[model samples]
Target: MRVTLYLRCRGIAPGTVDLVSTGLKTDHRGILVFTLPDNHPETLRLGTNDLTALNPEGRVPILLLPDGRKMTQSGPIIDLIESTLAPDDDITLLPTDPWIRAEVQRIMWIIAADTQPYQNIPFIIQAMGEWGMVKDNPTRHPLRLHFIRREFGAIENLLTRCAGKFAVGDSVTLADCFLVPQIRNALLAEIDLPSEFPILSTVWNNLLDVPAIRAVLDDAGGIVQPLVYDAEQFEVYNG
Candidate 1:
């Protein structure tokens, strides 16, 4: 059964891109596309303010299996992909060793749960609107930056132990999957990753050549450029 994955293109949904690209790399049958027309409820299944109330599992990157089963949330989707792999498959985004997998999850979570949400543009814009603040208000961006950088700091320390060619000991793992997109976000936000986190910059540069990573990114029009918003000319995506 060919799977269908609905993803967001405009803002930073790196986790979705990561898992889908991983699925593609592992030779999973799937069609990956964007949620166009912005916030149309069908695609954006999670309600604007009450996602937990709607579906705590999450709302984007909805995957439809050929058997008519629906899947949501990046984590479980990734788990499904890994579980379906054949015994001989050479691609494994996770390590076999127990300790290493745990380490990989540690780094991945720092980005997935800790850092990425603050920069979700649609949520931020919606919050700004609800607060009756101008969308372009300078006060908004810094707040997200603060949290993102703090998480990045923690990731930096974690990577120091296991990072090699990728986020964990010379192989691309789930950690790498989560890492690249957040770095892409950092770049979009003009965070100066090269200056702030040279080790991460090296890992990211190395990731570009990986076939699956490159394919998904190329499909998305290369490295994500920030979608500009609010008349201030700050780069961002249309939400």
Candidate 2:
């Protein structure tokens, strides 16, 4: 059975991938696509709210797992992060230089896990701040976005060193996947996109062409269009 994950990015902020692009089941039975909210309650899942109660065993076809305790999409992305970068002992793949591969993995780490906090938390706060939707003392709305930007700002500088075609290393890696969506939001959050973030923005631009990511954005119909870049033109990378 093909399973679809519904993600709500309406309130997503700048510089981070949040309820937008984090779904990762990778099941072959069905293709993943975003559905409209008006079409909601009709899809497999109502919203992309990260309900781990769907699958407990951490199995494939994550949305329809009928047994065990459910694990959220978090587990799948984490496992992918580790496996995709880990060195392979099976010599069948590449007999190339180990040092180069190791360096590749190192850069992937910088883009994927290292850059996450900056993209997500800050983006959310910034979005909330923009609409003045943030609440008072019960929540530290005063400091959320400011604190997050400090982190993303650091990442923009780090990109100056490791960037080329992507945020880290010459080739695209997990970092690119982790980054593109966040960049979309960052732009939306109106985060200053000056030359200081050239490298980071470059990586975000490159990711606009990935078929999987593109498919998700393209399939998302109506209202959600404003949430993604070039939803007006179906383009993720403006450059």
Instruction: List, residue by residue over 141-221, the lDDT tens digit for candidate 2.
Output: 334345435556776776667667755555544444445544544554556555546566666566555454555556644
The runs of at least 3 residues in candidate 2 whose Cα sits more than 4 Å from the true structure, single-residue gaps closed, are 1-52, 55-69, 73-75, 78-144, 220-239
**Global CA lDDT of candidate 1, please?**
0.59
lDDT of 1 by residue, 90-164 (tens): 455667789998998898778778877777654555555456544553323665678778988888777788889
Give per-residue lDDT, candidate 2, residue 200: 65
Prediction-by-prediction clash tally: 3, 10
Deviating ranges (above 4 Å) for candidate 1? 1-58, 132-140, 226-239
Each prediction's Cα lDDT score?
0.59, 0.41
With a 3 Å backbone cut-off (N, CA, C), the pairs that clash in candidate 1 are 227-236, 227-237, 228-236
Which candidate gets the maximum TM-score versus the true structure? 1
TM-score for all models, in order of appearance: 0.69, 0.46
